[model samples]
Target chain A: MLAIRRTAPDPDGRLTGIEIADRPAPPRPDGWTTVRLKSASVNHSDLAAVRGPGFEPGTHRVLGIDGAGLDEDGNEVIVYPIVSGPGYADPLYDPDLRALSQGLDGTWAEEVHVPRANLIPKPAGLSWDHAACLGTAWLTAYRMLFGRADLKPGETVLVQGAGGGVSTALISLGVAAGLRVWVTSRDPDRGERAVTELGAHAAFSPGARLPEQVDAAMDATGRATFAHSLRSVRTGGRLVTAGAVTGGTTDLDLADLFIRSISLHGSAMGSPTDLRNLARHCATGGARPKIDSTWPLHDAKPGIARALAGDQFGKIVLHCA
Target chain B: MLAIRRTAPDPDGRLTGIEIADRPAPPRPDGWTTVRLKSASVNHSDLAAVRGPGFEPGTHRVLGIDGAGLDEDGNEVIVYPIVSGPGYADPLYDPDLRALSQGLDGTWAEEVHVPRANLIPKPAGLSWDHAACLGTAWLTAYRMLFGRADLKPGETVLVQGAGGGVSTALISLGVAAGLRVWVTSRDPDRGERAVTELGAHAAFSPGARLPEQVDAAMDATGRATFAHSLRSVRTGGRLVTAGAVTGGTTDLDLADLFIRSISLHGSAMGSPTDLRNLARHCATGGARPKIDSTWPLHDAKPGIARALAGDQFGKIVLHCA
Candidate 1:
């Protein structure tokens, strides 16, 4: 079986020691079953494993957090990225909580072993590529917008950084849910495209003074956009964040936060339940993930390069067929 | 009648421009009446007017934010510190929202002209000094705990600073509300006193690791304690702030905040309705603000000095008889 693995971590360079090699098929654990991969999306976390601090240091590990596949029964499904033990009140708080690639053989292989419970039935109308997007980034955006922020229809949301997977998902998902979605981008082209192409209500240059503060602001770009996100919200508004791809530590004006009655919530990826709801949301709204490019699993370096160069507008996926 | 006023704006020194001078009593406006102030609490905001930026520059205004007094009809009352125009939904959001000292003659006088609606009935059992405490700092603490944080009883809350008016009030009010309150202090004596005297469940040194994470953390100490407050809460825990006395700007690790699903909420003083409920909470629980020291209105310098020096355990009051 062909597997994409981070053979070694590159602290200072991109694609330091990635291996596209042949390996014996992995055996499934009890209550787990084999799924033949149809498609798997390349995520920032996948890049982080090879380019930054690998989750399991010194050990080579396969590196995909999400995928669409066919179960043993031939049912098409999307693997829930997070792998946690059962009966936990909320899997998010599970002591052993971790994304798919963290502890198990990941989904970026021809055949992968995953918990049966993680196999969510992909909607009949959705394609494998879109289903592949639901397990991580899309699910994160779904939770941050709906479950974490409790944003409602007709309310306004400001999205900081208009180009990333989570940010683009937020704009599209929010728009489909009847939210007034505003986006900010340092690149004028991206900002303009966000309004003209992504169904955003408005778009502005990063940190530009808004006509009026928004009901909430979403930022996954972290330090680069955090200050602007803080300043963009109305009093008693919500600010939600997922990954801080730029920088993590940023200055916060405590008085501005408290005096304005703003609530900032930190969120990571979502629960299996959230992933299921995200699929329903996308299916119901006829919305789909934006795929920047796709490549065969054996030839994924070019797609990875596009993501590393920050040239992709949305997800970069690899097809396993 | 003698009134405590900021006769001149002092940008550098404490009490530098404060005046305990004789002035004619103030007149009431339409829809307003005179309240003969029995007692007034000196707040941090008062010292700020002389030492930092006064809310309204070039205005030699009276300095108090909260007062307990008798209405013209001899009805005992405590003036809600906020004075805003009528018909505005959520006075906190009102454009005309200002504290008693901001745009009007403050309550640190023999007689203050206030809106009829700003008067909350003083409980018969609450002392004049305690009644004075309910209008600003106490009300702010009340709102931070009950209104902003939505902290349920039996949940543990961490108070970042063990002293200061709001911190002390948080301790007392939270304990009375059936919460398990923990406190942190730089001063060992204060930390010890918090547990022995203020009914706090436990105390820790600033930035000291807790035995376990708390459900919520309260911080008004600002830059000095913001990081500790951010680190002390449980996953998805709430961090509520009112005033940032130390400094307003502090570094926030967005990854720590978002990855753990923590919520940080910014809040100012409570609304008039909150003020009324605060008074009732104090009265019903038989809880009262700790009066650190008391002074007559004519000789309020010592009380002011205690607050400015951060030597007081709770509130400083000036009585006008």
Candidate 2:
């Protein structure tokens, strides 16, 4: 089976040992099972782990954070890309896994081993490529919108950044969840794309003030959009963050947060229960993950590169059929 | 009537020049009434107003953040220090008035005028000093503990920096409300005092490891105690903060917060309605504000100095008789 593995943390370039290579089939441990990958999605975490200080310093690291496949018994399933300790029941709080790709060998390969508890039955109508996108980014958006923020139907939500996986996921999922989803993008074209292709009610420039303050603001853009998210939300509203791809340090005005009674929820991927809930939500809402592009297992570099370049919306998946 | 006034900001020196000199009674605005102040409590906000940045460089600024007195028409009332606009009736989107204190005159001295809505009925059995203490710090603590954090009885709570007004309020009120209150302080004696006098379950050094984790943690000490507060809470617990008196910058590990699903609630002084609720809660529970000592109106300098030095446990009150 061919895998994308990094042998060293390259500073000036991408993952050092990037190549199509073969490895022995990994056996499943107790309470864990192997997913024969049919489709695996590429995420920015794959690119960051290759060059950034993600996991340990110098070892072969497998990259990919989400996948859809067949369980050992041949039932279709989505591998929620997290591998954790025996005590890792919540999945999100699992000590060994820092949201899928931080330390664990994630799910962008021919086959991947994951805790059985991380597997959710793929709905009959959902395709493998769509299921693959639900693992990290989409689940994160779902938890941010519904679980952490407790957003209500018809409530307005401001989504900072319109073309990334979570941002695009938020537009679609929020709309399907009955929220009036508005999106922000640095590029007007991307904003237009979000409104046209995704389910966003409207889209604007990064600091373009909305006509009305939203009930909640979903901000994965980090410092680049944090102030706008703070300003965009109505008083007593919430700001939820599941990712900080941009810079992290932002001017935090304590007085503003207090006066408005606004809450900031630092949300990561999600719990096992949330992952299951995400599957159910997407299935019941007839929502599918937006796939930017798909490639065969051997041609994973371009998909990873596109995700690293921040040039695409939705997920870039690698299918291994 | 006598009033304590700050003629200038003195960041490092004693808050002086404000005198209990004779003045005409304060004139009331529409929808406002004059309170003949029988007693006013010295909060750190008062000290901050007198000696810190809240004071204008060249204006005579009245100083006090909490008071109890007789409203016009002879009604015994406690002044809710914050005077909100009519917009506060629907607080969901309105900027809270408590945040407007930087520009508005604060409560202190002999007689003060406030909007009628900021008056809460003072129970006959409660002392003026106790009622005054509930005006700002106690109400802030009450909202954080019960209203915002949504704490349940018998749950464990850790209060960082045990001796301040809000921390002491949390300890006393948390105990009265059936929480297992644990507090942290640098001073061993204050910790011991907190355990013995305030009914805390246990006390530890600022960063001392606890025997067990708590359901919630209240942090006002900021940089000095934030990490420990983050560490002390159980998974899925709440970390509530009202002030950052010591300092605010800390190396915040965002990963830890998201993994544990910890929720951080930043609070300030609460609404007038919440102040009334706090007064009622104290009356029902027979709880009194822990007063370290009371100074006469003329001797308020020393009380202000003590509060500024951060040496007092519980509220330092300045009583005007």
Best by DockQ: 1
Candidate 1 Cα misplacement greater than 4 A, ranges: A1-39, A50-62, A69-77, A84-96, A109-125, A147-149, A292-313, A318-321, B1-39, B47-62, B68-78, B84-90, B93-96, B109-128, B293-313, B318-321
Backbone steric clashes in candidate 2, count: 0
lDDT of 1 by residue, A202-295 (tens): 8898779999988888899999888888888876688998878898998888888777777888888888788888898898897788888899
**lDDT string, candidate 2, A78-106, tens digits:** 87766555553365554445544556666
For candidate 1, list the clashing residue pairs, or say none: A258-B266, A258-B267, A266-B258
Q: Against the native chain B, what TM-score does each candidate's chain B reach?
A: 0.90, 0.88
Q: What would the per-residue lDDT of candidate 2 be over residues B27-54, giving only the tens digit for each residue?
A: 5567767788877777666666655565
Q: Indicate the residue-level lDDT of B168 in model 1.
A: 88
Candidate 2 collision pairs? none
**Backbone clashes, each candidate:** 3, 0
TM-score of chain B of 2: 0.88
